[model samples]
Target: MRPTLTLIAASTLLLATACTTTPLPPQTIGQCNAEPASWAIGRAPDQNLIDDVLRDTGSRDVRVLEPGMAATMDYRADRVNIDVNDRGAITGIRCG
Candidate 1:
C-alpha cells in the first residue's frame, strides 16, 4: 500500500508538471524593407557590442514571429523584428 501510494503521488506530480503554457499559432512574415539607420530603443549604447542586439533593445509586446531566430522576452501581440548582421550590430527594426 505504501509503495502504491508513492507511485500514485509520483504520477500526480508528473501530470501536474506536464501541464504547461501552450505555444502560439503561426503568423505571417513581417516586413523588413531596409535597415534602421539609428533608432532609439530601451537598451544601453554598448548593448549591441556585448550581445545579441535584439536582446538588448528591450522591445517587448511582440506580435510577429522570426521563425528561425529565438526570442528572450515575454511574447506579446506587437512584436518588433530587430534584425542584426553577422557582427552583432542592429541592422534593422520593424514593429508589427
Candidate 2:
C-alpha cells in the first residue's frame, strides 16, 4: 500500500510539472521600434539618458530597475523598463 501511494504521488507530481509552462517574454517592448543603440546600454541611466529613452521610445511610463530588483510581472504595453547593472550601466531594455 505504501509503495502504491508513493507511485500515485509521483505520477501526480509529474503530471503537474508537465502541465506547467514558462512565462513568455514580454512582447510589447519587443514590438517597439525603439533603437537599442539609442539608449546607450553601457552608460549610466542619468537624466539625459532617461530623457533620450522617453523621447525616442515615446513611452511615458519608464521604469529604471537596478540589478536583482523585483519588478511587477504585469504587462504594460505603454511602459518601458531599463535594467542597470552594479556599475550603473544600462543592461537591458524591456517593455512591461
Best by TM-score: 2
- Residue 25, model 1: Cα distance from true site in angstroms: 26
Clashing pairs in 2: 76-96
lDDT by candidate, in order shown? 0.47, 0.77
**Model 2 steric clash total:** 1
RMSD of each: 14.1, 11.6
Across 9-84, the per-residue lDDT of candidate 1 in tens digits comes to 9999999989977889886343222234135233332544323433334443322223357666653433555555
Once superposed on the true structure, which residue ranges of model 2 sit more than 4 Å away at CA? 1-32, 36-39
**After superposition, candidate 1 runs with Cα above 4 Å error:** 1-77
- Range of the 10 consecutive residues with the lowest summed lDDT in candidate 2: 28-37
Each model's TM-score, in the order given?
Answer: 0.27, 0.59
Model 2 Cα lDDT, one tens digit per residue, 18-87 = 9999999765543343465354678898898887886677566788899789888998767778889998
